[model samples]
Target chain A: MSMRDRLRTMGLGAFGLLLVIVSWEVIGRNQLLGRTFPALSDVLATIVDPARRGLFQRALEATIGSALRGFVFGSIIGFAMAALGVIFPPLRAGLDRLAAVMHAVPLIALGPFLIVTLSREGTPTAIATLAVVFNVFVATSAGLRVGNPLHHDVLTVLGAGSWERFRRLELPGALPFIADGLKLAAPAAVIGAILGEWFGAPRGIGIVIVSSLQNYQIDLLWSAALLGAMLSLVAFGAFSVLERWVVGRFR
Target chain B: MLSPGAELSSESDKSADGSTDPSIEHDDISISTSPVLPHVDASEIGPANLSLSGVTKRFPLGRNDTVLALDDISLDIAPGEFVALLGPSGCGKSTVLRLLCGLEEPTGGDVRIRGCHPSELVADHRLGVAFQDHALLPWATVADNVALPFKVAGQPVDNDRVRSLLELVGIAEFAKARPKQLSGGMRQRVSIARALALRPEVLLLDEPFGALDAVTRRRMNLELQDIWSTDQITTVLVTHSVEEAVFLADRVVVMTGRPGRIQTIRTPGFERPRSPELLRSPEFHELVDELTIALDEEPA
Candidate 1:
């Protein structure tokens, strides 16, 4: 993009964000939604408040650790499933239905079952993995199918075996789609971790959210929610950059 | 045993110089031509005789509906022979090439390369093919693309062979460039280079230069001729261009559409390493004209 076009894009984004912040602050100050809603400034103050700094730090560390672990494990499992389907044509329809069913089952309903099976400490990562697997699986399966037909013909004429075809053509061709899937999966991992924490995890942003809601600590609740949003946004933004690089290299 | 267009043989006087050494005129070529333009030696490449006996192809159009693409086609390609399949659009000339490559199977009869099934040649890694699409991997550098056949065959990539093939196609400087980075002609050159990497016995070309403009296509034809001169692999090219068929092939198999079958097979008895000058000769135009008329004739 040209310098002016990039600047224009940033300017437009800033304007939209400013509009959102101003409307939020206005509604909170006027008590438009009653005492439950807090102004943006009050939420920021609570987030930076010295007394709550240690608590926020521990929660952030735990949630981030779980999300990262889930993202890695989910990506591996998802890629493996997609590769398996490609290798075994007979399994493709079954795998597709399985992925659809997995995605259809809500994470909230699975939270209690996960807690019982894996205990409170493992629930967060498990939920995050479930949340990420479907996106990665769908994207990877489609990606594997998106290879150029001509390239396949070339390999066939070259006498490439199934393994060689997968390694040289299908794998390289699927990188862009896989990167895009990962981009979406990143934020999903964060949301899953936060949701998992709600089912009585020891310490996380979700715990802060639940505790603040019950105790009527409106500012703390808003602060925790905002922090969760920021984590998700950062994950999305990082993968966006990586996705662009992969697309440029592979596509 | 008269030729089909024998009445148009007035250009016989012009063919006297058809046997002249083509390398003497290489300096006049616009592109950086190959230096080692050897005459095609029949004994150089092994027995790669391609034969299709009573081959028929039918593609399913819809439920209970089928389109006849080719019918009752039979031809035998001798070793070290260059044959061109010429026809109008949708005449199934490409289907014939595809059958020989084992890309598509005939609904009837048999297709063989060197006395074995077409698939057998593919399995043995003795088949080379270049399509109109070029089919170059967009992500790979030209050098890697050329080395792909070796890797596919579970053999170590011969880098020296790859480099020389690029030079043979006159694009050695673009070795590190990706397919998207080059123009249409350049990409086709890379595709041709990759096809020749393994030095396969049978070479199949389906309008490898069909996508290029006229000027570039002519230049590519000359380059292909230079390349063909060295290896003399049993080649079968499918094309719509009458001139290209005559210039490149020892035998031009003309076909008609709608249940495509051979209309005529004309042998342009021009000597090896034919130069650009041959393209302008009266004999070349005569053969092209005859084939074009044959191509235009409606199938009965």
Candidate 2:
């Protein structure tokens, strides 16, 4: 896309964000949703207050660590699952059903079980890993199947074996799709990490949310929620850039 | 089925002798003039280098429904000969090429190269094909795309061979460019170069220039002829263009659509090293007109 077009798209997005912020501030100040909803400025003040800086820092660090670890682990497992399906055609139907079944089970319901079996500290990363696996598996499997059939024919006539075909054609062709899966998996990882922490994990944004809700610390709760959202957004933005580069090269 | 080694080596020996003499003389011709193609008579050739006897293909379209794409088609291509399967759309000409390359199996009958199954050639890494779509890897540079056959064959890529092929196809300068960065003609050239990389015993082309403009297509045809002349590999070209079939092939096998069958076979009988002058000749126009008429009547 041209620079002007990119700028115009960014301008429109910024306008939309400004409108949302204005509406949020007006509603919160008016207490339209009652005392639970804090004004935007009050939430910002709570987040920036020097007294609570250490609390916010520790929470962000723990949550970010869990999400990052889960994202990497989940991505590797997901890709492996997809590759296995391609390598063994007979196992494809079974693997597909497995992924579907995994996705059907909700992360929220698994939180208590994970906390017990994996321990409080490990639960967040485990839940985050589960959250990412389904999306990556589905995206990668679909991606691996999407190359031009002509390319397949060319390889076949050239006497390529299954391994060579996968290595040379299917894998490279699936890069854009894999990147897309990773981009989508990023936000889910963060959400899963925060949710896992809510089930009595160590210091994290999720713990701050639950404690603030219990004690009626509305400003702190809002601040924590905003921070979690920013974490998800940052991961999403980074992967979006990577996705564009892959699509440019492989598609 | 023909045994692999003994027959192939003999066929190669015969072709090698025919091609060597013409190539030296061919180097004297300017780029604008066509290379002197070795004239090997279809009748004088020993045995079928590529044969399809009573070939039939039926594609299952849906449950209980099957489409008969080709019915009882048989053809024999001689060693070091160029044969063009010329027909209108859905004539199963491409199917013939597909059968020859082991990409598709015959529902009945046999498709063989040197008496062995086409798949045998494919397994031995001795069959090469170029499609209408080019199918060059979007991510790879032109040189790498051309080098792909060697890589696929589990052989070390001969960089010099790849470079010479780029030069042969007149795209040497575009070696660093990716498929998407080049024009349609250049991309097809790269595809052809890739197909030729391993020096396959048989070369199959399925409308390699089908997507280009008339001017570019004609130019590509001339270049293809020049390339083919040097090696004289047994080749089968699938195309609908009457002019193209007449200009390039030793024999033009015309076919009819709807249960595709060979309607007729015509030998243009043009001399080797046929030039641009041949394209405008009365004889060339007459043959093209006759084939065009035959193609027009294919539906009936």
Candidate 3:
């Protein structure tokens, strides 16, 4: 693509983001929804408040750390399962159905049950892992199947064993797809971690948001929400960069 | 007859169970475009005899329905013989190649290579095949794609062999380039080079030039002739082009459409190292016309 085309795309994206922010400020400044939704300035003020700096810092670190841990664990497990299913095809249907059933269970219902079994502290990471698993698994499985039939035949007649076929053909072919999954799963994992934190986690942005809402500190609540959104967006952006690189190399 | 220079034709078409490789030990090729193309010592690579006796292939179409792709098709390819299976679309010419390559199991009869199962020959890394798609890995360079068979066979990549094959196919300079970077014809050359990397005994080609334009396809056909002359390995090519079959093969086996049966087999008496001069000769056109008519003839 030309430099001008790239710049235009970037310009459009910035414009879209600016429009959303302007709309939010307009609505919040007008006391939209009876002051429950605070103005962007009020939230920014709370974010910049020196007194609350330690509390927000601790909350951001905890949420981000757990979310990243969950993301890595979930992506690895999901990728491994997909590879296993491809290698031993008889297990494919069973694993696919299992993934579907797990995904079908509501997060809210799973939260209480996970809290009882693994306790509130572990629940956040567990839920985050679970949330990322489905997307990663689905993407990887589809990617593995997306290999060209002619490539398969070439490898087959070349006397490539199953392992060789996976190494040379399926794995490389699936890289772009798996990278895309990781990009999408990043935000999901952050969302899951935050939601899991709500089920009585000791400290996190989720905790701050819940307590601030109870105390009617609308600015603090909005600030915590902003922090979670920022973390999710950052994670998404990082993975998107990775996805582009993988596609460049593999596709 | 194998080549003009190496006129080694065994009396019996079928190769004995165990024999030395049947490659034509040609001294040189006249394609001056390439400088000193490396010699292939395919002498160690025994050209395996291929036999498909009363082979029938039927694919399950669901609801207890089956489509008969090949019906009682019997063919025998001598060691170092280049045979082409020509037919209309859906005539199962490609399927025949697939069966010969052990990509598909014959629903009936036996398919053998050198008195063993096709799978057995393949397991020993003795089968080479090029398909219509030029299935080069998008991620790999031309040289890497051509060197794949060595990797598949669990052997270290023979850079020298890969380079020589690339030279043989006239794509030595494009070795560093990826499949997407090359033209359609160039990618097919890489595919063909990959197929030949292992010095496979039997070369199976299913319309390797089918996707190229007319000029490119004809040129590729000529290049293939040059490559084949060096090592006249037992080859079976499946193509719809009558002229291509006549130009390349010692014998052209034409087939009828659907439930494909051998319509007629004709010996295209062309001297090899087939020159471009022969393509314009009356003999080549006459045989091509004969096969074209045979291909169009309805099954009785």
Candidate 4:
């Protein structure tokens, strides 16, 4: 399809979102949900008023900083673990069992334990980062193992060394899958950051959101949630653009 | 057609005639020998072009048994000659090409190229190969694909040479295009250009045109013959088509099915610089008929 056609399709989705927002505003203003749901206009006004006055800036900065740090640390650990697992059979089996157990453990359950054990300062963001790392590690390693047989044969005939084959073929072949995993993990990272703030944090969108809810300032709470959603969407969009750039270069 | 002894004596006489005029005498000796050695010269340059001594290839089957792909085969291909390995599907014709190209090792015996082993030449970047599938990297443009050998060998690419080779194969216009955008015939042409990029002394082709339509195949065969004649590179082609073998090859080496062996080495009687019209000639039909009968004789 042409570029213009693709843009138009995306534009239609935006238009549908506008309709949902208008409906939500009309229903909430009429007290359809008895003040539980805030009017969309009130949420927008709260966002604009504080954002214009820069009151939410520090909270926004704190949330973004913690999320970025957690994402970076988690991704690095995940990659290292995956490489170790792939290189050693015993390690792979051990990691497989460990990963299964880890996956089964609820993120919420681990939050308090991690706060007590890892942080004297009680930084719950660490727990969220750990959750994201394990998920990404599994996805990337599985993708790497799915190399094409025909492409492998071609490399073999060329007498390519193991490292050369991986660099030239396997890595590029696994990129699409790795991108999928990263996309899935991105929102999880943001959520983990927010969850950590929810349990215990001096500042962040999650803290503001909780306070707003406790005070019955439903519009402010909704605005904070909206900001978090936008943050996740932005991260996903950035990775999507990266995927396109990489695939385009190869093609 | 003369006896093998006469052909042998003629080669010896041609050597005595003059070492400077080796090319002409070689063609004469080949044509004079039973119409089986079309234009091949058995004269030595420095070493034999390709030699397989009692080569055997086997694949491990399930538990205790093994399937013999090639069995105790001995063959020689001189430099600057066109040889076609014609056979049925399971005949291991491609196996022979792979062995010659150093893509696979023999289970027993030896494979030598220009008096050195296939492995030795492969390391030195002297081997060039083309397969039935035209394994061009989809990501690379036509020009980049043709320059792969140079890149892999750490040699600087000669842009002029790449262009010339592309022109030789008649795909110069598609240099900037991706493999996915090109037609099947055009892609094969790009592959041929890539194979010739290194100017390899020995070219190994495993049914390079098997995927093409009959008309395209015939056209490619003529183009290949012209290239072979002009370049004088030793070419070993594996093909199932009898007409292709008879049309382009100086010597057609027919192989039998399971545990493939050389059934016969027939020299086609057609003249040099073969054209499409030669396909309709009586002599061409006779050669095809002979090969067809030989193929039919193998037990089902």
Candidate 5:
């Protein structure tokens, strides 16, 4: 893409964001939602408040750590399972069904089970991992199978063995799909972590929101929810960058 | 089946391919040939014989549907001889190349390279092929792409060989550039360079320049002819373009579409290291027109 086009896209994105913030301030200040909802400015101020800095920091740190751990674990397992399906075609349908089945099981339902089987702190990461696994597996398996026939023919005529074919063709060809999955899984991982935290985790955005709401600390609740949104947004942004790079390289 | 080590050059090889092109289907499949190698009329045969004896390929299209892409095709490509498979689209010219490269199995008969199966040649990295689609790995640089067969064969990266091939194909300057960075013609050149990197016993080209523009295609044809002349490897080229077939091959084997059978096997009497002048020559045009007409007609 040209420099002018890229700048235009960024300018449009910034304008859209500004419009949302203006709407939020206008709605909240005018008592549109009965003052229960805080303005975007108020939420931002609460996040950076000196008195509550440490509280926000600890919550951000814990949540970020859990989400990162889950993302890593989920991505690896998902990629491996997809590769397994590609190498062994017989297992493809079964693996696909397994991913679909896992997705069908609600995260909220699994929360109680996870908390019972594992600790509260571990539960968040586990749930986050499950969310990422499904996205990554589906994308990876589909990616591995795609853009292959011609390349497969090239590799085959080059005398590549099954291992070499997987290594040289299938793996690289599937990278863009894996990256896409990772991008989609990022927000999901954060959501999973927050959901898991709702089941009595020690210190996280989920915990802060739940406690603040119960104690009637409206600003704190809004601040914590906004922080969670930012965290998910940041992860999503990072993965989008990765996805762009991979697609450029692989395709 | 004709063994791979059989005579690479047989004057009778032409007759073995027969006057009736497999591209055109007649009611009679009464083609005559031994199950083994063609009866050599000439004593001075070449070094390597890449022969397909009565090779038939039937692709199963879903449960009960099966497409017979090749039907009892027989052709012997002698060592250092360049033969082009000229036919209409879907005439199974690609299938013949695929069979020789061991990408597809003949549902009947055999495809042999050097007294062994095509797979053996491929496994040993002694077979080179370039398809119409320049399947250069998108991630790899031109140099790295050219060096792939070496890496695949479990050999150390022959950077020198890769460089020379890139130079040979006139893309040495773009060695560090990835495939997507190059133009269509340039990518095809890189693919061709990569194919020649190994200097295999037999080279199979399935319309390597098919994707290029007309001008680029002509230029590439001249360049390929020059390359092939130097290497003198046994080769089978699959192309629908009569001009390309006439320009590049010792013999053009035209086939009919749909259950592909040879339509005509005509030898273009062009000398080695042929020039652009020959392309404009009356003889070349005559041969091209003849093949084009042969390609246009279907068997009764």
Candidate 6:
């Protein structure tokens, strides 16, 4: 496309963003939920207050660090398990059945048991990691299974060995699907980490929200919620950038 | 008549005296009298260049009966000869290519290349194949797609060789472009370059240009002839178009339907390094007509 067309597309996207912000500001100012719904300005005030008082520097670090650690651990285990499943049919079949059973079990219900079994030492990191693992595991396994049959035949006719075929054809073919799964799992991972914190944790956005609720500190609760949303958006944006880089290389 | 064990040099001299070089002419005299001897000497040299003896392929039909895809098929493709297998859709034309390439095994007979089974020599990079579909990986660039055969065979990339082949196929400028970015004929050219990457002794092409339009197909046909003449690799092309079979092959083996068997082989009496103008001549039409009649007479 021409440069003028590209500029018009970008301009339209910015206009859409402005429309969303205007709607949110108008609704919040009119007290749509009868004072329970915080105004956009009130939430912005709370976010800036912590930074003004200089308390946000430490809290931001603690929340982000725990979430990042959980995401890394969960993704590593998920990918290893997916590779194992592809290599071993029996293991893949077993995992498929297990996933079906686990998916039905609510993630929220597992919180109390995970705290007792894994977080007995009061480490919130372990529980958060556990929550993210299930989501990543399912996504990765599904992605690996989506390799195309025509591409497989191309490898076969080229006389590629089984392992070589997996590396060259199957792995690259599965990448787009795997990247899509990871993008989706990013936000889920953050939600999982924060949820794990809600049951029991020394520090996290979830703990702050709960404490603020107990004291009826509405502004603080809104601030914690906004920070959690920001963390989710950041993780999502990071994966989006990585996905573009990978897809770009292939193209 | 030349026996299976006879040397080709003596037989070739005998055949050349009575008729023009079989490579340039298609005639019934050529078909009936041309030596049926194996291409390469198996005893002194390696295996027969490419041999399929009593090869039969059958698929299970659930009941007691089996569907014979290929039956008692035997042929030898000599190095640097361009042979075309001309048959209708269900004659297992493509199946023969797969069997020779070792993508599928023959149920009843042997597939030998240079004295070894195809499976045994695959690692040596002796076999190359092109399918009906271009089969270029959409994500890979033209150069990368063409380099795949070498990569899979664990050979180092010969960038100069790849560039030359791209130039031969007239697509050197599109090396950095992805397959999706190129036109259909361009993609198939990339596939052809990839098949030649290993300098394979035997090249198998299954209707490689059948999907293209008439104009594109004719252009590709001319390009293929030029490449084949220069490269001198043994080529076996499976095609349904009679014109394609007549234009490209030293011998067009017309196969019967169903339990696919070689019914007749026709030799077109045309001079090679064939030009595009040769395709419009009366001789080409006569050759195409003869194959068409043979095909129509075959049992469905």
Best by DockQ: 3
Residue B35, candidate 5: alpha-carbon lDDT? 19
Of the candidates numbered 4 and 5, which has the greater lDDT value?
5
RMSD of each: 5.2, 5.8, 5.3, 6.0, 7.1, 5.5
lDDT of 3: 0.84
Over B1-300, each residue of candidate 2 has an lDDT whose tens digit, in order, gives: 233233334444544565422234435443312333334332232212787888899999999999999988877666657889998888899988888888899999998787788877788787779999999999899999999988898999999999999999999999999898899999999999998887776889999999999999999999989888776667789998889999998778888988998777776767778788999999999999988887787455
Number of the candidate with higher lDDT, 3 or 4? 3
Record all residue pairs in model 2 with backbone atoms less than 3 Å apart, i.e. clashing: B2-B115, B2-B116, B37-B273
Provide chain B TM-scores across all predictions: 0.85, 0.85, 0.86, 0.86, 0.85, 0.85
DockQ of all candidates, in order?
0.69, 0.83, 0.86, 0.26, 0.66, 0.48
Report how closely model 5 matches the true complex, as a DockQ value. 0.66
True contacts kept of each: 0.85, 0.87, 0.87, 0.11, 0.85, 0.53
Docking tier of model 4: it is acceptable
Q: TM-score (chain B) for model 6?
A: 0.85
lDDT tens digits by residue: candidate 6, A51-140 = 534555555666676677877887777777776788676798887777677667777787788777877223445555655666677777
DockQ of predicted model 3: 0.86
lDDT of each: 0.86, 0.86, 0.84, 0.75, 0.82, 0.75
> What TM-score would each prediction reach against the true structure?
0.92, 0.90, 0.92, 0.80, 0.88, 0.85
Cα lDDT of model 3 by residue, A110-187, tens digit: 989999999888888998999999999999999999999989998888888888999999999999999999999999
- What i-RMS does each candidate reach, in Å? 0.7, 0.8, 0.7, 2.8, 1.0, 2.1
Cα lDDT of model 5 by residue, A77-135, tens digit: 89889999988889988988998899999999999899899998899899999999999
> How displaced is residue B178 in candidate 3, in Å?
1.4
| Cα error, candidate 2, residue A158 (Å) | 0.9
Per-residue alpha-carbon lDDT of candidate 4 for residues A1-251, written as tens digits (9 for 90 to 100)? 89999999999999999999988999889989887787888878888894534647767777787777778787777766776675554798887787778878887787677667766224545855776788678877886688766455445444455565666566666676667667777777788788888776778888888898899877778888988998889988887787677666554
Model 1 misplacement above 4 A: B1-47
Task: In model 1, state the lDDT of residue A194.
Answer: 96
In model 3 chain A, the worst 10-residue window by lDDT is A32-41
Report the Cα lDDT for candidate 4: 0.75
Docking class of 6: acceptable
DockQ-based ranking: 3, 2, 1, 5, 6, 4
